[model samples]
Target: MALAKGTRLGPYEILSFIGAGGMGDVYRAWDTRLERDVAIKVLAERLACEPRSLARFRTEAKSIAALSHPNILSIYDAELEHPPLFLVTELLEGVTLRQQIGRSAIPWRRAVQIGSEVADGLATAHDARIIHRDLKPENIFVTARGAIKILDFGLARFKPAFQGKPGSRATTVSEGGSLMGTVGYLAPEQARGETVTAATDIFSLGCVLYEMVSGHRAFNLASPASTLAAILNDDPRPVADYVADVPEELDRWIGHCLRKDEKARPQSARDLGLVLRDLLAEPTAHGRTGAEFESLAVLPFFTSASSPDAEYLADGITETLINQFAQLQHLRVIARSTVFRHKGKDADPIELGRELAVSAVLTGRIFQRGDVLVIAAELINVRDGLHLWGQQYKRPLTDIFAIEEDISREISERLRVRFAPREQSRLVKRYTESPKAYQLYLKGRFLWNKRAIESMRQALRYFEQAVEEDASYARAYAGLADCTSMLAIYGALDPRLGGKRARAAQEMALQIDPDLSEAYASRGFSLLLFDWKFREAESVLRHAVHLNSGDAPAHQWLGFALGLTGQLEEARGAMRIAQQLDPFSASINTTAVFPVYWAHLFEEAIEGFRAAVELHPGYWMAHYYMGLTYAHKGEFGQAILALRHAAEIGDSIWRYSGLGYVYAQAGRPQQARSVLKKLDELGRHQYVPLIYSAAVYAGLGETDQAVEWLRRAAEQRDWMIAWLHVDPIWDSIRSDPRLQGIRVDLGPKP
Candidate 1:
């Protein structure tokens, strides 16, 4: 399909032949309508004649249009309606990389620059779910202005996903296979004709990068078949082996991209680009590069507003940024519970970063006047206290989403932490388009974090109003589910309500956004406590944590579900992650120690509990749990002291009944009876879970009374009944027929 000079197709005149390839023939052409010089890729005869191939080519050409990166050759149009099918693209004035690299091996830094540019183009396409099946030096052009442009994107599919020629390793795959990549640069999975992903392009890019630095093919052998085998089974020689003064880190980083297991490769092109760019920045940044994971702490945004609603706006900014940053797999964002602890203390960003042991700290001040918001943000490098990035944004409140997106993008660019597609979507995901609904949701979250009974009620009201304002808001529904679950957990509401109100809210949230991990976490809580579906609870909780690994509460809940079902080691592991993410949370720390306490590792549990207690001395929940752990350790005097401290802090059923149970465990029958009597009088006026009384009865060795009370507790749908299958307090009446019957009625089958 060679076109002669002066041949006209549609409005474009083929002025001269440029080159030829398997997919098409390139020609210098005149665009009559746009009155400009352009490059035209005239399709091969087989592709032009086949309707299916033509349609597929047209569809993929549109996908390529989404990638308008400077490093990517711009496609002007896919001319399909004309007799001859062709693609119009930007003309280039530089030699192919194959010609340029033929002179000599490129310098390491220059090679890194080229690789970074290629990666930036790949990132844009990959983020749009487009895969470049073939990438080689000949397909990369180095312009006269020193810029690189990727050629023939989405054109590899003209033959197969790898197109090879028998006995010729010029640039194609073997003849017998349907594979489509150039033989030497084919990724292992592509060589095997397996399904491709964004990682496949990463492997090909690594081969190109290897060639740039070493001035030779990454895996050239005696034949294309031999090269394919090498790609599948062998590691390329390190760039340093072939070139002088190439850093070992650069070699290792390339090796990560060339890994045979695609899973081991960099998950996203943008992430790898950032790593390479950082390596390039090492000389000026005091010779530093990111370690395993870059850690960051986003301190709570300071505010000038006095009203609670206006303050909620500031809290929203801090929380939104933290959630977005946490989604990056290569970044460890400090949890909200930890960062919010220094909210009003005016902590220095440098000091906070050092205290949290993170690479950087992000501090912000937010001021809202009427409908306008003014935000000043700064990202400081912890080591030298240099401002990595800083910006001030003044925008109408209605455009908060755009403002946040710009801030997030700028920060990630400065920090060299780019998000994968999934993470990018999560970062810019707008739960509600309406600014009013967003404000209501933020107020709801602020109230929910307070964790008080009355505040939770207030949070519920706000969440309901948020959804009323925008019925399609998934986050508002997630908030409803979380608030309702907390009320049920604290015995402030009937456990039966979890199956009704909480269940509906969770289902609605999932319906709107099926990947909402927090909603899944709330559903797991209900299944564990109210439905007596222990196995289902653990499965749902596991899925929740899988969706969002940074979710401390999800990990904490999963730990409880695992510990109660006798999976002590796994429970301890989950809790450890929760504790790591939320270091300053008293409840998280105490529950993080729960699996150890339940495993009867008394000394270990004692150490864990004491550490948590010391960190949060005023948290009564920690003191109460320490008492139970001491009782199990047979330290009766210390147990009594802990329980007394718990009772002195709060006189609720948790602390009061817990004291009675510990008193009986210590053999103080008279004191235990007095506490039980006090509970009995109080139960007459309020809704007290009989399970609390049952706990004291079990400790006192009153078998019949405990069994009767357990039956009543099961009838009332009390949450504590779920622990019957695991709690050691019930070991005394382990074989009682009445207790077994109650367990059958209340617990899941082991």
Candidate 2:
């Protein structure tokens, strides 16, 4: 019988039923005795009445109650009553690892950390001779504090089995004469009916870890029998086959744990825990650095001076120092626009670090008196709230550039960074000798970093004005290149004209000072997007990093190029570096957008765009992407809302096709027809617009109209055909012969 809300069981008062599974029915309950919330897992009525099963359940509860690791869910009470046999556990407010994995694969560092914690909890349990018979993603919970907790110890087993209770009906045999655990995750020995040991848990943990990394099951099959067959006869595809970036050593280690023979696996959970703990301790042990040094946020320098002009000069000096440091290849320097958020605020470094997910933070103060400048800089380690480095610089105003260089060199040295020759040159080159022009250039960069079309135009104006003020200003030309490149990207400028201008601006900037890495990054974007010279784009993007290892924009653009070229792992690594540099940046928040979009990962694109919009509400482009994602997902109302918001924010009409398609599909045929009519009236309905119309019409079951529009789209040679195989929206029409013909006409598969 189902328990109703408010039902009392032992000392717990039932609040509401949460869920029920094969093992038990979970309920949200109030621990009246303890005055706190708890979750009560009551065994099935039949199982509860079975004396032997109840005895085993009690035994398992006692076994779990003894383990006290923070990562293991605490069991508060276990009781037997007339109606229900239940175990009360501390209530968790967060979702399970299963839910998170289904949403999206966790980052490698986070996965490792979570896995390590799980291993630690298992170690504690295994030390007490308790083994979890079932270990899967569903049993791992992530708390709001970002800690991992292992649950479901109510099914765990201890050594030395006892006899069944009097009048008990429970037997040792599993249902269906199969393994007791979930099929895909069961250990080989368990499946073969062999007695389970701690190694079985380790083997199951290996499967969980593998799924976390690869986003697929280790023993996937069409049926239970087939799944069992694979478990007995097959070896899983190497983890590296699915995710190329997984380190070989880590893969081998996990493989060892998944060995068919229990003895071949780790001897105990404690041994596996030790290995994971050691991996966590070594920053670069797995041939990757885990989460260390991914990004840095450089807070604007606070000035003690009262004069506004003096403060501006101090700010300019700070920017110059940042620019110089940004030339280092391994450091991603958060652009000034993003870093300014912390200006003048008494920010807690640790809180900021956690929020931003950056490894280090740089903050300082500057003072100007007459012809002298006094600057103090400090780097704080975010993890430990410890000061990693600090320096005080007092120098003549005339030698401000030298002071900036000295600061960069010292920081790099302290961080054990080795600068490439191009990076060294970029760091040493003075952008402008005139203080006014330098200040104007800094202001221009700050505006350009906003990444909005209007901001780009304003930034271009500032750059032009700066150049007029100082003809030899290399940084101003770099600023112009950045602005023009952004305009070209958003379709705000005709590629033919904008590409030429961007190329000219970048070339001029490099001619003025060949060491300007930002100029090269801009040039790379132009080449990649307009010139379509993939090789040249790759070379330039690589050189940009070589020229300025610390330049966050270089890493960002490089990631973009690599992603477009299908080098996803390398692209993600580059983006990770960019994210590390500017954890809170609007651009960084949306870094995954370009990758997902280019790869036609529509679902991931939708999620990335949503995350971006949440992080920076003013980013109209994010809204635009969200609309595109919604259109692809067949969520027409949401698509229209997002598109309208983008339009209200004055976004360009480049996303019209997506908006029009969604409108048509959402039963707003008149509105879609009107938009298409308007586009035709404006002579702006391109191949993509026609193709989108085809999809919308097809979704509305207007087959003939869909075919006609698709023919037009095919005639015009829509570029998106390269993604047809993977595009989810096309699923509705993929089976139609006409659609197949169009696919053939578009050339071989993308």
lDDT for every model?
A: 0.80, 0.70
Please, what are the lDDT tens digits per residue for candidate 1 over residues 552-625? Answer: 88999998888878888988899889989989988899888878776767798889889989998987888988
Over 1-750, each residue of candidate 2 has an lDDT whose tens digit, in order, gives 668988998778999988887667889999775566788988888887667567657766787678766567868787765556788887777789999898997654456556766777787787776778778999898754344678776567675431223442222236547456778888887778767777778888999888888888899899988998898888899988989877676778788888998789888676676576455445674775433564566677877533334566656666776676665666656666566767777566557766766677777767677787767676665765434445556677667677777767666654555566566666666778886687678678666756677888888898988999998888788788777766755546655566677788888888998766778888887766656554567778899877666667778878866765667777888988877666556776676566666566778888888988998888676887788678776777788999778767744545565566677678888877776766566456321235656655665667777778877755543433433544455666667787666542211212
lDDT of 2: 0.70
State, as a TM-score between 0 and 1, how close model 1 is to the true structure. Answer: 0.61
Residue pairs clashing, model 1: 162-179, 162-180, 162-181, 163-173, 163-180, 164-172, 164-173
Candidate 1 weakest ten by summed lDDT: 160-169
